[model samples]
Target: MKKLIKLGIALVAIISLNACTEDDGFTFIAKEDPDGLTFANTPSGSYTLTAANADNMAERFVWNAVDFGVQTPVSYELQGAATESFDNITVIPAGNSTNVAVTVSEMMDLAEEAGLDNDPTTAEPNTGIIYFRVRAYVGSNGGNVVDQFSDVISVTVNLPEQSEEEDEDLPKLYVVGNFLSASGYGTDWTATDGVPIAAEAEGNTAYEGFVYMNVDAPQFKILQTNENFDDNYGDAGETDGVYTGILESPGVNAGTPDGTGGYYLVNVDTDALTYELTETSWGVIGNATPTGWDSDTDMTYDSDTQTWSVTLDLTEQEATDNGFKFRANDAWDLNLGDTDADGSLEFAGDNIGVPEDGNYTITLDLSNPRQYKYSISKN
Candidate 1:
């Protein structure tokens, strides 16, 4: 009986050993490594990028590796954007490598996209900052579930100013005329107090603005300065109801637009040496109007106030649907809307907000150039 019991114990021990060796059925759960990544090599100071060193290295971005709980492969990449918020990101693959070397040409492209310009006349600055971050992802996919990102880093880039910038300051002009004195626009309202028609921009030669003239056969002159008439333009061939005219500096006589007199949109070009005037009539159009985007509700022009006024019973649907916009001559060729909803008008901008269903007097004032404004008075 003792020998039989020993044999049975040996058989049980061997069976237990075989069961322990067959533990391959256990599942391994891999949780994303509960850790964050940071820049291991942060570049400091501003870098001046040039075309000469376009092929040279800009900087080397290095980051630490990630262990995704298990031995699962973790892929890394570099992300760059012009904005600090990282909108519109550009991706550069790093594969399994933790470091990425960016060339000077690549950085220049980034700086340019960030609005860095070497031109002195441009509104954009020469130096700007570009943003970057490192992304560590697990497996082959880089989705939100298994992906983690390093803190954003900013690098300042500069473009050297051009030695010779061809563009010079654009010319400016002022409209001086007889209609100004009686209007009480300025203290004197003569050539000295002439309404301005400056260049559209600092480096542009063309000038534009709105002018209110209530004179019969309105006569005027274009002057370079409001202080003096030293540089002035007069009639080369100007006539009433004529939309455009060529002018000669130190001209023979003042410009006589044989107009019945109302508000006119004026445009002057120094390069072309010509002036154009358009008698514009404004209107309102949208889902808010009576025509409901199919047509226009024309507004009447007031010569005294230099405004286009209209009274309409805005639809209830307008308060929920699209609002209205001020367009010229019942056409979308020239339309203005409250882009910022700040009562100021921009071309092809956001639709103006519609008021509650009520009769309101809406005024469109294009008398001010670039500073076009509108008014809404509840009736």
Candidate 2:
């Protein structure tokens, strides 16, 4: 009987020990990492982005859910960078989801931020390769979660050619110093005398305009504003035509044109930190003009109206069924045409035809830009 009683006590003690160790919703066992956390639908080999494709999806990164051997929810993040190691990474929160669709505009923004040039025409390589990876994490609101990363994938990013119309909202630039004077030095550095760089368009940061330079005062500096020297730029060296030029200190060597001083079209790109001074002249070249298609009839600048104007006699032979267009420096490379034969001037649109042959005063008003207007008044 005693032995039986002892056996019964031992069984009760074993049952009590098991009960003490039981857990309702917790354990000390280490959780296994979620499986199948790989990229399911991968990106393409190459992607070409343009203004038209801004709303289109560039890539849809699909991945399997991570199974952390539990019922815990997981969050996935899509990250990208220029470097393969993702040292300079841009993380895009994908929420507690398994897929994320990136738009072309979004990808372009990322590529540019990653040091890829936005210009496709002149940029070396033209196509930038970007690396991407997916990371999955689990926890209560992302607290105390384990991170698992998928294998990296790369995609080639190609940007469309930057249209002149797209660059119509850049900052302004000015021309100061000897370039304005015959002695290679100007007494008045005031805004009135300081040549203003005409903006490419009304709301553009890029600027272009013609300036007369003489050998005596060939040197010049570019300023953001004509009233102050707070923001001005000069040549980094004596080198001319350096596209990637740096802004030198004041009173330093100024930039000169490639050839002897003449009328130059100064083009400045503030965003790219580049400038170009090319000898240029403006003229009308078309069948409808007095000069006809064989030669050009030049337009003179009217400072009062801030436009180019000319008075010419349009004969019947030149005006009848003939159209005209404006050319820069008498070159076809840079010219203006009209579309729908409307007053709205396009870079290379249709021709502006004469309704009737008569003596007229023509004015090309580029003050508002992109909305360039012109009027031909028959006299």
Candidate 3:
């Protein structure tokens, strides 16, 4: 009876101690990771699972080690599954390291098992996704040992779709800069999310567009494309004031226009390896402002908040029903009108109706991407 009592007390203590590691409503996955496995470098892109590049490292599976709050040695194993459902699982033991790699050949096997093929005649898909996960466990995943699983990562794979026509390389210039992250476009200085400047036409050297960046001294480079950084253009340390700056092939990031910064009308000459920046000044234009439909009432820029605002008297013409729109450089080339009349701005959208005639404060905030908004407040 004493032995039985001791065993019962021991089991209770064991369950109480292990309760901290328990994760409910999950299968081999942790509810939260105090220091759970995190991927280090999983470069983005699709894969063509072919034997030609079999030995090439598809993508290195990297992650931070999991901490079960114990000193026991932890071992990791890489896992793959057909879909988000872990019903069909594949495992690759990675020993005790926190990082491992899945080669093209190995991915090819997984692809074949997932019923993907390069055959053009069959109903099987040439494109599919493979989900990945890594397991962290102590004591060889023995009974009651601490173990946790990382979040699933899905990778798109293709079996090389057959095409009769060759793909044309449409030359494009993507502006990769430090201002992107500040402006909330994407990762700073990364071509993967850089803003694009397309060629004027086929076989043209001039690339023109507008990008709103708040960096006082704009530091940037022009990437050939958004996929890879194989080709790029950047500062050659030559400048003709804020109007233009010289560019060099395969160059590092560089700044332009000294102190002038705001929305810019950019023009890039790829052949000459030079670029120009035209700082745009925005204003309210239409028949409603002090300047009738013919001219624009200039708006002031607030660098602290990165907005264009104006306080002016507006006339509500109930007769002719005239209204105003926002434009840059006192011109129609770069203008915005609210198509939905929902306080949002779209390129060359419809004219905005005046709410009422009054002395009002209007503010335009272009700091956020695709969420350009304007606010009109009566003072």
Q: After superposition, how far is residue 182 of candidate 1 from its true place, in Å?
A: 6.0
How should the candidates be ordered by TM-score, best one leading? 1, 2, 3
Report the candidate with higher TM-score, 1 versus 2.
1
lDDT by residue (1-379, candidate 2, tens digit) is 0000001110000111121122211111101112111111113334555443354344556665555555767777888887898888888788987767665667777677666664545545545777777776767544666666665666666654555435444345668765555523245354446666666555665777656665543666787776787757777665543323455544244555443666566777666666787765667877767667888899886545557778888643321135687787777877776553324466676566553456767776554424555665556
Residue pairs with clashing backbones, model 1: 240-258
Model 3, 1-379: lDDT tens digits are 0000000110000111232355311222211111121111113334555443354344456555555667887788889887788787888788877666566667777777778977666789966788887777777565666666666766666666432111123456788777887765678878787876656357989876667677667677778888777767777755422223777776656565754456776778988878887778899988878888889999987756768899999765421145788998888988987664445577787776553467878788765434466776556
User: Which ten contiguous residues of candidate 3 have the minimum total lDDT?
Assistant: 1-10
Q: Rank by lDDT, descending?
A: 3, 1, 2
Residue 258 shift from truth in candidate 2, angstroms = 3.8
Model 3, residue 337: distance off in Å is: 8.3
Name the regions of candidate 2 deviating beyond 4 angstroms: 1-170, 179-187, 191-193, 198-205, 212-216, 238-253, 301-307, 315-322, 340-344, 365-373
Instruction: Identify the runs in model 3 with alpha carbons over 4 angstroms from their true place.
Output: 1-171, 200-204, 238-244, 290-325, 329-379
Please give the distance, in angstroms, between residue 353's alpha carbon in candidate 3 and its true position after superposition: 7.7
lDDT of 1 by residue, 76-194 (tens): 78888899898888888888877666666787788888989877668889877998777777765644446666656676667766432321233457777767745445533367777
